[model samples]
Target: MKEVKVEKLLINYKTLEEFKRFKEYGHQELSMLEDLQSNIVENDSESPFYGVYYGGSLIARMSLYKVDKKYDQYFEPQHDYLELWKLEVLPHYRGKGYGKSLVDYAKGYNLPIKTNPRVNSHGFWERMKFQKATYEMERDFGQNPLIWLPEGISERNTQ
Candidate 1:
């Protein structure tokens, strides 16, 4: 596989159109368009989303948002971490390591990472060394949380 260049997608017709390929395209996507047009965002704004393109086509992508330390409830040292979501690889590109590459890109931060494994994707998350956060009735209600910790950081286990 050729090198996949990961870039912060800009809000524009091309990008919007590219997103339509995603099943989860919805309000959040529209909001980005709206924000861009309304000048709420810079023309070339740096979005939290990062994606890898294969010769002008977006084959894999993921979003990693930084959560403030004040809201840090998952890690032991109580530091800021990334909330990873919307990690999707184009159906045609499945099994090509693109998804894992996107994940590996996120891990480049070496920060505590949290993600909700899509149904049946538990094995992938596990293979990536992400663990289910010990059930927290209040914090993790209705969600299966998977987390990856860098060295020197630990999960705040629930008793």
Candidate 2:
């Protein structure tokens, strides 16, 4: 299997246009567009998005944000970690390992990662070795989060 290069995406008109092809396009993307249009952020400003491009087209993408340890409520150590979101591969590009490649790229950071799986994506997250976090009413209200921990890290005792 050939490796797919996951590059950090920049916030630009071209990049935003490419994002329209993704199924997860929503308010976050629209907010970026608004920021660009208003010049509140520069055209090529760095974004939290990472993606795989094939033949010059974005085929897979995800957003990763680092959360400070102080705000951490998911992992045992209470250290800084990554919160991954918006992982998607274009419909035509599914099952080609593009999604896995994007996920592997995030795992390369070696930080514990958390993501709220979309409905029906449980199998994928399980395949990725993520476990459903024990739900806490106040902390996880309206969300079901799955988490991946690097060696020696474990989920905090949510019981």
RMSD of each: 3.5, 3.1
lDDT (Cα atoms) of all candidates against the true structure:
0.75, 0.79
How well does candidate 1 match the true structure in TM-score terms? 0.84
Where does candidate 1 clash, by residue pair?
A: none
lDDT for 143 in candidate 2 is 80
What is candidate 1's lDDT per residue for 1-159, written digit by digit as tens? 766567777756676666666645442532333333443254477677677888788767777788887888888889888988878787778888888888888888888899876768898898889998873437677678889999999888676
Candidate 1 accuracy as lDDT: 0.75
What residue runs in model 1 are displaced by over 4 Å at the alpha carbon? 24-40, 135-139
How do all models score by TM-score? 0.84, 0.86
For candidate 2, lDDT tens digit of each residue in 34-131? 43344325556767878899999987878789999898887887878898987887778888989899889999999999998777888988999998
